[model samples]
Target: MTLSNPADGRDDPYLWLEEIDGERAVAWVDAQNTRTDGFLVDESYQRDFDAVLKILDADDRIPFVGKSGDYLYNFWKDAEHPRGLWRRTTLESYRKDKPDWDVLLDIDALNKAEGISWAFAGAARSPDKTRALVSLSFNGTDAIEVREFDIATKSFVTDGFVIPKAKTQVSWVDDNTLLVGSAQTPDDSTEAGYTRTVKRWTRGTPLTAAETVFEVEKQDVAAWFGVNRRPGHEGLMFWRALDFTRSQIFVERKHGPHAGQRLQLELPEEISVGAEASDLLISPKQDWTVGDLTIPAGGLAVIDLASFLSGARDFDIVFKPTPERALQSWAETRHGIVLELLDNVRGRLSLLRRSEAGWRETPLPGLPDNATISAQNFGGEDDPKLGEDVLFTITGFTRPTTTALWNGRSAPEKLKSAPRNFDPEGIEVQQRHAVAEDGTKIPYFLIGKNLSMATAPRPTILYGYGGFEVSLTPSYMAIAGKLWLEHGHAYAIANIRGGGEFGPSWHLASRKNTKHVAHDDFAAVARDLANSGVTTATKLACHGGSNGGLLVGNMLTRYPNLFGAIWCSVPLLDMARYTKLLAGQSWIAEYGDPEIPDEWAYLQKFSPYHLAKAGQNYPPILITTNRTDDRVHPGHARKMVARLQELGCPAWFNETVAGGHSGAVDNSKQAQSQALGYAFLRRTIAK
Candidate 1:
């Protein structure tokens, strides 16, 4: 794909850099890496790197776990175990400070024995939790190879179920059968490079002989299959049409007049479905008219699956969001359902149970204020028989994370807490609002010390991610606390539009044609900070990644006077060609297709790579990405850096050899990459 330059009717000269693994492209990357390393290998950068690495590799960090039968499993990586170790322990021992864990898999040892750098993707276990399908990836890419393993033997099952590396999905239907989706052939993948066919594979049979069960059009995003087994409900097979936003769901009938056949569900394409026992919970993203009843957007409703399957349209409204309160997530227990609500961007937990009258709500107590609360099913999301127990974590910008276990009748019991990585003695947090150009109120969080003294502006770094309906909430920042706050710098996070901070409306207000509204909201927050004497433009910097990188890219190109430095990581800079990049076609529903005439007219306005000109006074920029990132192509960062350097702008570039989209495979790599970023910020703005 070639991008047209409207001004001079020419093509981008740096387009050759898009050849990710070409000899010329690799040589260019190596040269850029050497230049960046030369500037960041000083004594100050080394000190910062060591400090961040120490905090990351600290053994006092909490080892969070997931319950499976009588064991609690966790994946851990430290100085000794760089790749990581998958281990498990008893619930009783897990509650203790130093639990005795049984190692199930050693990734470092496996890598050594196999002579490959295979990263752990994940594992899907059988119902009995004694066997699992372990997934391992090459260089941390999305494509992975799956092998069957027996927990009792602590070894892979020889000549057992195995799938070669491709974007694949698998679920255990029984000990002898599995519902699988994978690229059977080169032509069996969607345009987005995902599997378009699903099959049923039996034990002791060759994978090529697996029977094709379901398939979708290659133009669609992908297809997936799974088995849902609730406690009092019969097992159900689910097939999903994986479109970007609008899709269809079909369920296989186990025992009925249409047994062994798939039936399409009668529901709106914009609604989400969740099941627990006989209840079918629906959350609508847009207004839906069912029979004579209308369910508003952001509303929750429930219906009996038996009645629904029988063509019954009667439904009961379970919960409705007001202007300030919106449902975030829900999980099921033995006899009750837990609802997580976001009220004005703060989390609130509530319990719901069904009775003769209707579903009733019970208030949960002892939840800390000004912190984000995440609740999960006690065992796992797919636990067939979850009991009346839930696990939760509470965290804030200045407070470390604390994990707890909650029963229905009492306050949450504290299980473990993360040891403090930095001193929070004089830290303070405050919520402030900024009014956008369109008269919208944007909320943001500020963390710093001696805020009462406004005589002098402090060096500050502002962060934001304003797309994909992802909300940014308060969370502890250990590196920021130790490297910036302790040394007298302020940090701020903007809750801009295109985020689910308020509700579906908040995100819709800035999506598609109105994408510029999110950029305006972020700029408003920066101006608010400067006007309040929190910081000056000379001492202000901006940081973001992924969609957030797009956010900061716009700031540097359009409003460079507001920031002294810009750090963009794993960004999508060439908006004109984003849809043609890896996994980029699937996100067209979020970012409009630039191939269309109308969409390109609007998209070109924010295409940072195209907007960057030779005469603009752009801020100093540091673009970082990973060579193994299959999701967002690293060429976006490479091309942007090359364009800026040609324009005589101070630009630095770095790319790691592993870690995929995250740019970090382990604690040491994560710390080292972050240390380079922080060191650049200190030199450009804090000095």
Candidate 2:
């Protein structure tokens, strides 16, 4: 088959599908959905859906909370409350089996009262915590409408601050003041459809009266602003995100002739900034060399604010990355810094503090090995006593999540544990390595009921998301455990390049022109699974979403024979026109600019849309997306499926009217989507 270039995507047959809500395009989607349901929806599918929903709405599930002034905030969704309930509880009550929750807002009630589908995105609390700027998303998209809410009264303020929906960021500067990053006009947004301007909005004033404080180039990714009201580091901060991995930091001058003016920080664009009491935290995404001192990439360093502002290159290096170790995240507590480190893709917790001589680092013990540990709330910002207590969650492939708390003096205490959703008596989890085409040992986790493969290869699903420096860590897949693993099927996660599993170097190794390295790495894992007898090409399927959707899309076009089916959701398939679709322009730094001829030459090689050819025996695929997805336009999925069908391939497309880039707004929608994919996989490969 001779392949024809998209020629900048102008000459494409299914280009009409790009009209996301067009009458003809929607009619096509409805037809496709009906056709998909005609075959996939059955007793087994319903059973799978119910089982997944049960896990999602389980009463015994851990209620993760974020620490506020006097309460721990949690947004909960259950069978009864599909929209969710924004509630809070005291730490004392939260430690119990059934915490006494005070519901501040009921989303279902709000949606019913307003006659609209509103999803509670989050709430940004005021400095005093008596008020909040609540964000509500329409059908769970990234864009949100911000409205002021009086927490004490538990209602939206009658004449309070309200910002109409768009890709916006809101942070409380004081009880009556807010620092907002949003597009005042359509022209104020970047090509990626994100806020390019920052404004200071005060209470009792029209939004148009808000003062513009900061702005960035229209070609930049976005502009951001915030006020740090921490105990000692109270000031205004601004950031200009040049791209995914590069940003410029600026601070408002406080006590000089330049007071009230923004001063750009003398730091590398690749390094991130944060405040730690009177100290400044800097984590370099790339190696930083300053005045004969060098801070390695992925290392954490801190210096006192006074010295840093007064031109000091000396920094207290607390953490450094190694070949197998990387700093995942860190938090500031009243007395110390809590570090979440990843050692060979496994979670490790540590604490750093200033001692008599200098800084000291200590490993946090009593953690479950081989499990992923994430800090839920590092309390102590408000009260020094609460700082001694830190909340975290632990989970793995087979183990359900357990939310734990670590006191300053002792081992972490398990506060709540999620009920086991699936039987794991015979399940086993193994961390294995698959050598990539370049001889790089790619790490992967294999979970299954049978691992030896002494008898026959089992039905397997390999999942991967290899972009944006995002690390794929292990988690308890409750739905997969009940839907796939309980039936003796196998699941594998490939920690390929273009991910931060091994830190910045690992991700940068495959970014831009070398992005194909990630696809090659994923294919290597699939081939290894087949060769190792864990699974065969005839029974193995691949799954990925968003960027992962792009990952498996490549697997389908580049190595179609390596697997039996593909499950892609909310994908970016049309690379040539990606920059013009929703948030695709923001990813130019990672995937390279397709508009550039030289870059497109390499990008076209990996573009699944352009690579798809007729007369090829491509495996069956179920491509799903959402009409309301403000990020990664749904056009990618719609166009790909149309082209595939035209080429006589086994392609199925499902476009949900609601949801966003995630493709499911709530649990019911999530369950239906999962069941559809699982059913499709079972029909095409599991048998």
Candidate 3:
């Protein structure tokens, strides 16, 4: 089969590669895998693979647990149980060095018994906690089969709820009723291949006979259903995600004179909603005006749920955004809410409680500052004893992660800590600034043993992802620490404008028609590293995956003279056809619709597949992806490599058969894929 570029009406020679499982494509992939193995996997490569795998499979690694009734549940995987074991233990036992865990499910044993490869996706427990809806993904794809399991028997319930694999979403309304949405074809799904409608399914009834509760437009992203069973605030909720950054919320009355009636919320599409006790929490991405009052963008405000539903316009602003400080996330406890804030790219935590007067805010005490802090609603919100439990994880570039719990009163108590996976002895982390063409100062974190160029420059890897409003903060680089940093090389994370480091405005400044500003910011950082003499162009390597893959793809094609090697993984390279592939349609709000002539004019400028030329001085690049990556189609990587190779440029390709968009299923596979990328960097730039 042959395909042609819609933009220029030119025949596309590598278009057949887009046939995911076609015999010709499979043969080509097998040959490419063998060739990549011959080029990368040597004695030295084995050493790199072993080091990464050991760290991944280490027994002493911290086991993170979440509360569910009487047990703290955890899913564990190691060399012994490569597929993993779902287990649980008591809080007292979890506090001990060696917890006495009770195994609930053995994935490897189940796979062997069924003669199939299935990865444990996750489990959603019922409110009673006696049963759970277990999701298993076949071959590591996003599509999953959900089965009901009994906690006591530790087995799937006979004749219980079972959903065949598709992009399924399940939420339990009670033990016998569920709000389900599943799609297996375009007729039942949105343009992005996600469930387009939600239905009410009762026990013992065929799913096809379930009552339709809500439906969304085929052009919209998707519709999701949720149940809010918070004491007196019980109701059914539905939300339509119009795009990545816009949504409309709805609430259905479960009990009352208005039972069975759904009410569309009076809210801006850009505003997000949450609930705690009897109060309604809202955060607007754009400034919102209610009556004569205005709440600035990125501010957190609250109003009584009863009053809000009754058309009351009284709202109390809890947290207002500053130029440097913005609300990152928040979690609810019994008596208060824990706020995660970002101050100039650093993490900060605050606690807010209700008083007779109004809301009172205080700084959370005894937690590390200048690090990434994630808080979750631990111990179910309704638990009588552990209702106020908030679990927090704290870590930095060199700091090993530590889990702590705050009981809504005292300082957080450290529960468990991770062992030092890599040697951090002579290393230092520094935050540097790069001045872009628009005079924007981009902040980046540089980690290295030494940052001097007095004698000679050192090899370095610069990484970035500048879209989707995703913030790239400080993180413990265990794999890189073992393979790259331990070798005395440097690593830097670029906090460019397209990220949420500075909140919504930061992201909006560099997206859509102005997306080139993000690539410009990344190039500015690359130049800053060289101008500072930290590394020369020939010794610098750039790496990014997914959306970040597109970042380095631009660096490879648009700024080839600045880097020695590029590692792009699971990327969206062929912008012209991206929207038509898998879930790519959902991201049109981010990249613009190429079907529109005006949009295509600008999109082509950033498309790496179209930018390749025969005589251009392109640097060596390794494009890697997974065959089962149903998110960003592998055709992006396949076609780009073919185009570059045909143009006589140095390019290599490697793809694994399993492992979704992340490109790995198990730790061993993850280590192998990672080792291949690091080996390519070592071979090309780390002389």
Candidate 4:
């Protein structure tokens, strides 16, 4: 069988069905940095049983990308190796007395070796460098635990922490206080939903004294107790909320009875919100949007909460107007916030930081190669070509991660993840709509090497995450291009409802009782592709991680035959006991509260754990999660697999020792995991 590029405009689509599955698995990487290679992708690089835990710790410093600058910050802790979990300083709260720098949080600590138990997935010191929040999974009944740490004291308060019936969410309002947003847990309640809210906590209060700040009243934030992985925890939980639609800044009154209290902070209908809190720039226009919506997400503007929410009207709009560019980073230097933008998506270094008074744009440094980039892994890449600048893997459709950097200079690199084996000389990536049964035009990204009937039914894979308000964007991905498309595969990214693709509203469309919309959107895409003659169900596969994993699990139950194989990673399938599982108690906001009889009635209808039929003939499923997954309990997978097996369902389940929500502690280990995933995909679909 001869495989040709399908997008040559010949309308040829059906090509891969006749081709042998294992002969090769086609993967097309979008340009270079448009997609990223998730986990490690090497198959034969398997670690020995003893070496498994050791290898996962290799990529410890997988850096984070800083705003407005090229600097990346990454952290790694290895208990097996000499670089023990405690890299250096002693935490003040962990100290027996008022912390002295010399006094170790556990000077003669018993659990010192397993201290950093999990990845840096928990809270850390805020920009003020005053305090930090770290969550860890403990053995026995201690499913997961949170620590209110004091950076100044190098100690952490072990008590007074909130422990959910399942999981607890901590957002620091300031060094002295933090908010624990958790779903209500009932004596008879059961459902691993990301609904509900509140669980107010403070340092001196007894753990039992934690109070409820506010319950989300369950609207669609899709953030289940911070279940899904998205962006740095640095400030996601800002002390305030904004009128995302009208660009109205709703500030929590720092005075009065509500002094320093975290508020729901609703926004007017015409404001828009940038994904990040720092990027929550308010524009002057009453209505604006990114490219699709008509809200207040224009270039950038500054807003004050006291003026809007309090009706003070004390400030005007032009406090600081962002230039005609994306404000990539902002710095609170001696003068004011230094707004930096990378005007040219292709260049290394930023054009300049235009001062409020039109200051000269300072040149960012350059891109660093081999930079371990992630939403959280900040720091520089490993490449010298990028000198000392912040590194980014930038490319799309055809380009790869080109290196650049910023050493306090201006040059920065936009190219981060570039491809090596496959060439994107003629591939194409386009955005299209997959209309839902309810008349909603859900957007999805389609990528193919040759997309016509002559290239018809080419092997395809679709990915999604419709639960959390997490908007799927293009980033550098190397392995997908290498195996899935570069070899002649077509893939789709469904940006369905239950996601923040269009701000909070999009997610609301499919959260809680409306979660069916997410599954429907996924099925609709698969059906669209099959009916449109792009690919048939036999040649298609579906994948999702975290909440998206739940997407896959739900798909199998409702639309059993839509996919050939399902790769559900770190998924929460058992909704009933989820809130009752390790850390499961935290995510009531996204799913729903099962404690209340009415919420439980609705929750039971959609809860996968309760709804999984006994004799259903579901498709083959491959599930993965971290054993030390303090975020989404591994028990979700354990119980799920056990139930499936007992009920005579074909299930493949694997649990990594650590890596928070995701698995494969390091790149080498990550590669092995990827290889295993690829192998599983091939076994079910390609084979």
Candidate 4 residues 1-687, lDDT tens each? 222222121331222211212132112111111121222233422422223334334332222223212212223344443222322222222122222222223311425655643323344444244455655544211234666566456666556344544444556555566666544454211233433455556768764577754443223332222211122212223222111122222233334344455454454444333322222344323343333433333334444443334443322222222222223333322222334432211222233233557535443343332122221112212221222333344444344544433344444423232224356655677667778898877777777776633665766788998876666655444566655676677888887888655544566677678887888998998888888777788778899988888888888778888777778887887665556554455466567656655556666565565456787877777777665555676656655655666678877766555455655343444555566676666667776
After the best TM-score superposition of candidate 2, give how far the Cα of residue 334 lies from its true spot, in angstroms.
Answer: 2.7
Residue 367, candidate 3: C-alpha displacement in angstroms: 2.6
Give lDDT tens digits, candidate 1, residues 233-280.
545545455566667777764544545667787888766787655667
Which residue ranges in model 1 land beyond 4 Å of their true spot? 1-10, 236-242, 253-259, 380-385
Model 4: residues >4 Å from true position, as ranges? Answer: 1-73, 76-311, 314-399, 402-426
Question: What TM value does model 3 have?
Answer: 0.97
lDDT of 2 by residue, 288-363 (tens): 9887788899999998765677777799788888999999888777548889989999998888988879888898
Shift in Å, residue 527, candidate 3: 0.6
lDDT of 1 at 621: 92
RMSD of every prediction: 2.3, 1.9, 2.4, 13.7
Screening candidate 1 with a backbone cut-off below 3 angstroms (N, C-alpha, C), the clashing residue pairs are none
How many angstroms is residue 605 displaced in model 3 relative to the true structure, after the best TM-score fit?
Answer: 1.0
User: The CA-based lDDT of model 3 is what?
Assistant: 0.86
Candidate closest to the true structure, highest lDDT = 2
lDDT of 3 by residue, 1-687 (tens): 212336432466788889899999889888888888888899888998999899889888899998977889999989978889999999999999999999999999999999988888889888889999999998789999999999999999999999999999998888899999888567679988898899899999998889988899999999887786655556887889898788889887555444677877788898778854566789888889999889888888889766677788799998888998888888777758789988888888898887899888897766665589889888774543226788999988889989998777677888998889889987888889999998989999888886543637788999999998899988788989988888899998999988889888888887778887888999999999999988999999999999899889999899999999999989989888888889999998898888887888788888898878778899899999998999999999998988998999888899988889975568888998889999899889996
User: lDDT per prediction?
Assistant: 0.84, 0.87, 0.86, 0.50
Which stretches of model 2 miss by more than 4 angstroms? 1-8, 253-261, 383-386
Clashes of each: 0, 1, 0, 135
Please give each candidate's TM-score.
0.96, 0.97, 0.97, 0.58
